[model samples]
Target: MFSFLDKFSSPVKAMLILTFFGIIGSALVAVSYTVTKAQIAANERAVLTHHLAVLVPDNLHDNDLLSDSLQVTDAQALGIAEPVTVYRARYQGLPVAIILNVVAPDGYSGKIYLLVAIAYDGTLLGVRVVSHQETPGLGDGIEERHSNWILSFAGKSLINPLENDWKVKRDGGVFDQFSGATITPRAVVKAVHHALQYYWEQRERLFL
Candidate 1:
């Protein structure tokens, strides 16, 4: 009886001790994550805002647009993979630009996430890929480092997408398509066209 008590008691105590430590460790991790959450998100936003400035190329009078979050479904019947958020920026109380999420799921490798900004008059201010699963060398030109290919969309309006204007040079569009990189550019062009169509169809919901 004494031997049994000794053996079982130690195992039970050890388990209790381990359980306590596990609980404490989990709590600490949760607390740390909670405390740093806001700061980390703010830092991320700052980086994106800087990128937006590069895309938009206008003096930021203020950063108020970052604060104005809008619902995606309220304005349009977004595709399942649509960007998660849209923000409307204002200059001196007037709507200057809109920053919205766009996703091109037809990317050769997978979906490509984008942040697109357009002026009230439907002019594209800037476009930045927020996330993508495109091939490394070829499709990556959609990124800023490879080339300014995506930048071609800037200044274009929905009124003039010129689906005729939506191809790589090989395909005879005003833009240059990558060598051995047709699908990626095609997906991007289609996504941009969709975004424009969304803006055109839902202009009232967006502006109001």
Candidate 2:
């Protein structure tokens, strides 16, 4: 390799070596991505299935939540700038619940992702924080692992809390906030409420 390079100018030799390595690097990257693509997708599906099970549960629905999904787009109600996936759970051909992948754009640090499960008749089956960047000990309470606060949304409906009382206690609502954190819970509450409203507006279309 050095003997061949010595025949050419130093700059040209270096350029050829750099170009050769670049192509090799690019090929390796492409191969790696192709090899891992399927595994990545499978892992994502597994995580999503786990989240859905936590919200809808195994006994609640007989249908496959992963397969029965629809895309929904509602910037205002769902707070989604782009269309998001909604997983539908059914039992014996009847709608059991619909899980919306909602984004709370007003989270304290940034947008908070949520999986909101609403029963066929607008009752909230459960709500889970899929991901968020809220503060560690405070705002992170919205997570089920961090605190049971997320479970409070289960069995609740828009009418149960009343439209006016959908905010955190600091905001004069029924829900409680962390000792030093309020924005995280408030944003989640607002997002879940919007998800319920979105389901109400699209209930008929969703099941179809």
Candidate 3:
């Protein structure tokens, strides 16, 4: 006494229903992501633009970040594995500052990424750590807050690294070291020293 409708009520029908719902759900997710992608991209661009502004002087105007020439190979030659971007911050079409990426591969835990902007004569306009893996509380002073140690890096030059003049005070350098964290400042000093050298060596390529 099999009923014809019993076949339609079987697991196959349930599977079909489930499959249909899955397809619809996936399509909805895909559409939602596609629609929101532009907004997400715009937000990311805004963040980058803001960070770039911190490097440029307030008096300057007409800054175009994208127009600045970028070179990946030159960065690689200098031991930077990641793509490094260079921005020419101009005041009335005259170069005023140079914003570039610096990589500190010898960080205590891992690599530390930095954005450094310097005037043509080598005055450090600003230095911001874009990314890092140092100890959460102990080594994070490199940022703008916990400690103003990073500020000391400004105005230093490659001509006088003063390794004796560029170390954490604990190590007898002019810069202050974290009370409980030595490696962090040590790594930062080395990175800044290397970055200054790299900047001088690449000035020709960067300016043009």
Candidate 4:
């Protein structure tokens, strides 16, 4: 009973109606947010799992990669200014590989985020471009969807490339640079190389 509204002036009644609707709307919004939050989180987790799987295959790791993560920060080596998450994968309680969220700050357009998976013994399992703003059709070739260039990092290591051959082919290394777009690939190559070096320096601590 809203019969009490009969005693109020028309304007007051209108105001009261609006206020009631406002409260209801607010409540509905809160309920919707509460209801969708978990689903949104689950969707995000699913997407992350897919990305992680791309670098560290599901068959290679038995442990929960999402739960087994470490925070690492090495501006010079990892090219990140702040702490970044490193997802660790294990099989039968033994280290399988680590997926690092690395940043290449010198991309042609801006910074490039990468998912680099390195095995326990410093071998690279895979590398994926998570995000980047490189020029379309050129620098964007660093993306696996754009080109298979990123896949070249698989199975590589600091020693496999001899440390001196980590740059793009244009720079006298083995990696290839995109046609007419060298800066983007160069940045990614450097970032991946640094990520490997960081892994080499912190391999023991990374597993623990």
What's the lDDT for candidate 3?
A: 0.73
Flag clash pairs in model 3: 162-165, 162-166
List, residue by residue over 3-97, the lDDT tens digit for candidate 3: 53366767867777787789999999999998899888888677667777866756664667657747644443334765677778766777777
Model 4 spans with C-alpha error above 4 angstroms: 1-3, 31-37
Cα TM-score of candidate 3: 0.80
The per-candidate count of clashes, in order, stands at 1, 0, 2, 0
Residue 174 accuracy (lDDT) in model 1: 68
Clashing pairs in 4: none
Best by TM-score: 2
TM, every model: 0.78, 0.90, 0.80, 0.83
Models sorted by TM-score, best on top: 2, 4, 3, 1
- lDDT of candidate 1 over 74-108, digit per residue (tens): 22323344336777766676777777678777789
Alpha-carbon shift of residue 60 in model 1 (angstroms) = 6.5
| Candidate 3, poorest ten consecutive residues by summed lDDT | 71-80
Give the lDDT ranking, best first.
2, 4, 1, 3
Q: Could you give candidate 2's per-residue lDDT for residues 1-208 as a string of tens digits?
A: 7787889998999999999899999999999998899889888778888988888889988888878998878899888789999899898999888999999999999999989999999999999887889999989999888899999999899899999999989999999999988899999999999999989989989999
Model 3: lDDT of residue 18: 80
Model 2 CA lDDT for position 55: 83
lDDT of 4 by residue, 36-89 (tens): 998988886787788898888889989989899989888888887899999999
The number of clashing residue pairs in model 4 is 0
